[model samples]
Target chain A: MDLFEYQGKQYFARFGIPISKGGVADTVDQAVAQAEESGYPVVVKAQVKVGGRGKAGGVKLANDADEVRTHAGNILGLDIKGHVVKRLWVEHASDIEREYYASFTLDRSAKKHLGMLSAEGGVEIEEVAVTNPDAIALIHIDPVDGLSLDTARSWVDRAGLDEPARAQTAELLVKLYTCYTEGDCDLAEINPLILTPDGRVHALDAKVTLDDNAAYRHPEWDEFAGSDVEDERETRAKERGLNYIGLDGSVGIIANGAGLAMSTLDVVNQCGGSAANFLDIGGGANADVMAAALEVINSDPAVRSILVNIFGGITRVDEVANGVLEALERVHISSPIVLRLDGTNAIAGREILADHLSDRLVAEPTMLDAARRAVALAGGQS
Target chain B: MSIFVDENTKVVVQGISPTSQGLYHGLRNRAYGTHVVAGTNPKRGGEEIEGIPIFATVAEAVEATGANASFISVPPKFAADAIIEAAAAGVPFVVCITEGIPAQDEALAYNRLVREFAGTRLLGPNCPGIISPGRCNIGITSGDIALPGGPVGIVSRSGTLTYQALHELSQQGVGQTTCVGIGGDPVPGTSFIDCLGAFEADPDTRAIMMIGEIGGSAEEEAAEFIATSVAKPVVSYVAGVTAPPGRKMGHAGAIISGSKGTAQAKMDALAAAGVTVALNPTEAGEAMVDIVRKLG
Candidate 1:
């Protein structure tokens, strides 16, 4: 769940972090109106999830309404790293005396929440890390203890921030940490934590990644869900409660687990067939779930043959076989299905399917054999 | 002779009830010769599920049954608290089988486990729990495919892949000593290195098979550990070579971010560490067979 710059700013403002007044606009007229409300000299920034918006010319300084309209018109459809900008964030431009970088993210190896602060900002932090490592201050904070003001002040000092900006930056870091933990975010970053010539400090840009698992607690996250661009097949699969990813091939793949599903795709390619999609039924291979999965895969006209590969663990192969039978009866599938069953109760499951085998439905014993059969059915010579 | 669990390991089941997954797996574990001593459910205190008495708290269950390990199957919302309670109750090893726990909650729970319960090792909050074949079967892994006192030790990040590898090994008549699924979450309790170290120390375990996927540097770190510390023959298979970038592939941890956490990177690291990198699941099993034969 990556947030647009406007949404990230709104999220940060909830925690008392100061951000420039901004309005999101989808049209040139709306961008001009927003510039008027913010009193001109605005930054019409393209709202995309990808980085390097400025480098891609998706960001421009608008001194007046005419400039805002021109910038907005150019940036609205601009593509940065394959993401077409559909929205523009109009914010009052800031007068910055200095720029600094601050971010909070989980360090997987250290098993702690990592906070990075650097006096250098506005450029790639990775470049700073490689060239002058000492310019950045890295702190690993235990989630239980959290970020204390004392620790934050020391971190700011270690980063060699200016003396006058130290207190306000530390105060803002504490609030940002609150927004990170309390806001249920995987990452809360404020690039170019700007210091005004008047000695005021505030966040200039926000990049936040919210944790999807924490959606149960935050009902407001539905807005973010609404903005997600989903493929039709992916949307249908989500409605059916199946884990699916659409691909560009002829063989539709269905497996039991994530790893097995991925391996299924690889093996399908190995057997001289490309996979049309990756669908994992998970531990639930019941009748209703299987029917829904089959319907979703069958809806894809690109699929020439379906591969049902099940390696049962706690999930019984007999139950999955019964589900496959029930699903075959429910859905009017156009493509042939190649089934491979193994693990617990696999023998009985295969026996149940023996009576139902036909030209459209075939059963193979090993995964390799099933993949080969499915590839052959998909018009590939295996 | 086995790692993590054996005949001597007494188990306490948390979130056990007639309808809970805990009760279901707890009974199966007991059937596999594990000592299913007690259960804990605050509302169902003094009640019994399949003849196992339910206590009000983990401390009571631990005290009464002398349980050292805990199997947690509570819902995601209550999973962190359940783990905290088990760790606080002095359980040396806690395996949480619950998925979808908030990452923040897991972070706090991990901190508490490290600071308060220093000796306790949490296996997973979204994993198929550990299994010592014919000794103790914990969590949802089907125990029938694994054979006790076998020469191979298996560690995996995915559940069904573990089952597939186990099935292939069993079909080839190469049994296992202990099989551990470290889960597929971004932040797992036990790591590949942790399990690899245990397998390296166990004398009954002659060879090791590791299954990993794209995501995180845990596999890379484990490869480093295998190069320096482990002397046993190690075979590895990493999934998601055909997977696209920046997509979560069913598992929360199986996503490729930027250039890191790719299957190729992990395989390269393992191969550099002197591990046999298998191209597919069957190849991984065959690699294990070849290693076991050489050891014999």
Candidate 2:
């Protein structure tokens, strides 16, 4: 749920955090029009989720309409860390007298919301944290009490931010905290909380990661959902309510749990077969869910054989076996399926599956043996 | 004695509505010898569910039944509040079985549990819970797979993986003192280190088995703790070695961001810390059996 630069800025603005006026552009003409609206001397920034956009030449200063068109044209299709730029954020360039850093994220160890304010900014914060840890003022915010204005001011002062910029920076930090909490963001970071010569402070860049679990509370997130570049198989699986990740291999894997599903993939590789996808049916191995999972995996032409690995805990293996049998009757699966059933009622489940064994359908006792059988059936040496 | 819950532990079930899964599991746990004392539901206060009294709040339930531990099975939205209520009620331990709670809410609940209710130990908001074999089962893990008063101690981040490891160990005639599923959330209530420390202190536990996945530095941190603090034989298994980066495998916390929280990193750290890093669950079980037998 990483936000594009423009979207991040928009999210920041929702909390009344001051951000430079910006518009998203998909074309050179649109970039030029955005430059006209925001006035000249704009920054044509590539909108990608990856870092180091400036290092990859995806960001450039455009002093005029011609410069905006040239820079936007160059950045629109630019690739930064494997993310191809499809959108440009045209923003009015800021005059910075000083740069500072501010970010809010959860510190898992501390079990608190961590707020970091540093006098040094615009460069990699990790380097700053390593070289001069004292330069960064790290504050652990109580989620119940949150960040108080006085505490924020003290944090700004402790970070050694300029005296004139302290009040505004603290104010903005409070707003950013609000944006982080109320906005349901996992992370809210401003890489250069810049101070102008006129003593005005504003956020130069915004990097936000939204919480996917909080989507039910915010209906407006549908716009962000629409922008996701998902694989066709992944999209179809999502529609079917199956957790599936498409990979580049021949053996389609399905398991009961997340850890087991991943282990299934690793064991498939260990037994001389690469997994075509990672699919976790979760706790529900009922008929409807299994049929949907089979249809999604069956739709993948790269899959030569399917591996159904079920280690039922709360999920009964006998019920899962019946679901698989029922799904087999419903879905027209092209690939062979090697089933491994274990845990609660696994013996009963395997006995039921023994009657359905064929060239296209098989069953194994252990996960390792099942993986080997699946690899062999997929034409790999096991 | 077991780490968290044993035969003497009195339990209160929170969020026990008619259709609540916690109510169903609570009854099952009570049937299995866990002291199921009371239940809590704001609307159904003063009512009795299967002969267990229902109170308006955790505090009332605790006061009425003298329950020291809480089993929360509420929906995600009310989970954090339920934990808070349990903690405020002077419950020493809370096992939250609700999943899909917003990370922020969990963060707040965790902080409050630590800062305000310092004596309270929260097990999970997304976990399967803890079990002490024949003693008492506090959470959702199947009680049949475990054997009481065994020599081995188990801790894990994944629910089914923990169950699988326990099943494997049980099949090999290895029993456990206690098994704790700390849950696989970014901000868990109890940590690997917390459970490790408990297992280290418990005299009944001889060897320990840890199951970790690719996500967070909890496993790595636990390895660091085990290297210096823990004197017991430790066998470990890390899942998601073949998982691709940047995608959350299954658990909310099981994601590989950049080069950190990789399965290789966790395994290497544990191996360097003198832990027997097993390739799979069965291998881990075998390693545990070997350690326990050597100890004997």
True contacts kept of each: 0.75, 0.66
Query: Mind giving the per-residue lDDT tens digits that candidate 2 earns over A2-60?
Result: 88878988989989999988799999999999999998789999988878889899999
In model 1, what are the clashing residue pairs, if there are any?
Answer: none
Error of 1 at B218 (Å): 1.0
Candidate 1 stretches greater than 4 Å from native: A79-81
What tens digits encode model 1's per-residue C-alpha lDDT throughout A1-382? 8888899999999899999987999999999999988876899999988888999999999998889988999999887987889999999999999999999988888889999999998778888988999888999999999999999999999999999899999999999999999999989999989999999999989999998888999998888774655468888998887899988999999999998999888888888899999899998899999999999999999999999999988788999999999998888999999999998899999999999999999999888899999999999988
* True contacts reproduced, candidate 1: 0.75
Candidate 1 residue-wise lDDT at A251: 96
Encode model 1's per-residue lDDT on B20-125: one tens digit a residue: 8898889988887889999998998888878999999999999888999999988889999999999889999999988888889998898888888899999987
Where is the poorest 10-residue window by lDDT in model 2 chain A? A221-230
Winning candidate number (DockQ): 1
